[model samples]
Target: MGGRHVLRARRLMEGALDGPDGLDEEELVRAARAVVAELGSPGRLSALVAELAAGVGDPSGCARLSYRHVLGFDKLLLVSVGTRHMLRAHVWHPGSHRAGREDIHNHRSALASFVVRGTLGMELYETAGDGPLAAARYRESLSAEVSDWLLEPAGRARLRLTQTAEYTAGSGYALPSYALHRAWCASPGAAVTLFLETGAGRRRYTDVFTGDGRDGRAQAYAKEPLEVAEYLAELRALAELIGGSEELARS
Candidate 1:
């Protein structure tokens, strides 16, 4: 049953990506929105988790890719189609220490996210000629050998907040790879989101901005991948959270 579910999910995603219009930005965003709506549905996601936890099918080695992101969230990779596309479940725990919550950054690939279990707040920013908000910019790259993040100081940047919005469960949004933004859990409890990224025209590095005055030196952060046992445990917990939540029932 789990194997069948996994196949169905993969096919659904592939169909979206291989649509008639190809991978144009508009088409990609449309596909992402559709796929996220379908897969992020409580029933579908819960079933997928149950099957993966039961060890029914190989998740394309994504089980080992799960990790705690530096921005204070658990990124559990659910599916990977090479480097072209990735589907992940992001769990943001309440009261978790957010080391880089104030750091504004962008992704290397176009992405979208669906709030599955709680409210999410997002703020968008753009570089300005002069602004009260000043930041130290960094060019962030990943080491292929060790998967560590290398942050090289770029220069100073002034930015202006352009937009702010809040999304509740059953809602979502998409963004281009160059969109500068920061997000956090706005609800009082744990929040879960389904995130998808497309690797078409992925950039080699991403721009990161930090308000902290650490503009003089470079920094490196280690990304430790989760062990298989730990990964399975997380999947099981997610299944329970989605399948047994009263709030989800009410929603």
Candidate 2:
């Protein structure tokens, strides 16, 4: 996104996602699909392109973050247009603390993130020792754990951090569930990445307790999927959406 185009993207993001119940999983996907569809018609997106790209001027590292409170985190949003299949751009926004956690409370979430600009720090981790982490400790510690997992997953409280090349606008990457991965801004630059995945197999987060046997009642990541009744049904439904068969999902 350059000049006016980013401005337009920003406008669309800010203006479109600001209301209550803001772009939750469903709305976000719906908006993304619409943006992709519009990109197909030059006649439709031409004016938008011009207006959006207008004041964007040049790429500045720091820009207003579109998601101040929406994500319940601090993050700026950026866009990317895929010339390939869907024409949908990856919009990178700040992720929640549990986005790539290694705690016992969290199962796994198969996630996909594609960067749109500058560089992104792909962090991976595993639980170190068996004590609850201080609030501040969790954030900073997890931020560094990316390296620990890259080295090996056999150790305790250990991690591996590897710096991939800086990703400029249009460059992106994917994070499979294999690595307890999460991304952050690596440069003084802004970025956007598209996220697609339900994360891990739909675990009965609310049904389980934390790793340390602590009550996880207050846990935000305690996800109770739609099928609070049958885990298999919910799991199979998600697998089918991604093209996997139910038999394979059961496996």
Candidate 3:
């Protein structure tokens, strides 16, 4: 526990020579030891940390972040810096939503997302092997019968989780590149989570993997590049099937 003074986020100009930028490939992964020092009591962090946690708890309620010139997007709030992967600050618009889409910028890196406040309903999809044309593919294995899934598995798993698959507030989830899933808000409002990557610079593959593999959530044991492509493609396809966007796919 530290002082009661609120946490003031230190600003780093994007692309500027700062504590976060200018690292090459190797340094990106095994860089200097990074840590987030708890500045406040165990009960409370600075205003910025607390605010970020609250936003992730309820993303639908989190309106897109807007600051005169800047668009208040949930994505913007999930900012990353240095090697610690600490959230310096966040800006959000309550009761907001976005659709299932890809970052498309870099797809080669391993990514993870964690939820803090809100709830989320996520699903994975894939594309048909017939070659990118056939209405996209979704991961599905006959679970004996759909009813069997509920009776045999649900009765046990349901208690621990919402039947809707919504991860509640105060909880966070880490999603891989190939896990194409969307967040859904319950009857309440916006929810939140953090998206993180293992590598650096502009990610190689798209951030969100359009599922096109066998395992959406869990890939095979092998670490082949095809495996990465497979799982990732499947993830994206699933998200695309419905409206991966915030409002449409929002649970």
**Clashes within 3 Å, all models in order:** 0, 27, 65
Candidate 2 or 3, higher lDDT?
A: 2
Instruction: Name the regions of candidate 2 deviating beyond 4 angstroms.
Output: 1-108, 126-166, 198-200, 205-251
Q: Which stretches of candidate 1 lie over 4 Å from their true place?
A: 99-102, 244-251
Better of 1 and 2 by lDDT: 1
Residue lDDT tens for model 1, 120-164? 899999999786689889999997778788899999999999999
- For model 3, state the Cα shift of residue 30 in Å: 15
Q: How does each model score on TM-score?
A: 0.91, 0.32, 0.36
Cα lDDT over the full model 1: 0.82
Best by lDDT: 1
Candidate 2 lDDT over 1-251, as tens digits, reads 45554455545544443346544434544554344333323332333323322323321322221222211222322343221111222223334442322232112333334443345655444444543432111211121422111111221233333333445444444433334444455655334433433322322221111123433222222112222123223223322322335323223
Query: Could you arrange the candidates by lDDT from highest to lowest?
Result: 1, 2, 3
lDDT measured at residue 38 in model 3 versus the true structure, 0 to 100: 25
Q: How far is 95's C-alpha from truth in model 2 (Å)?
A: 17
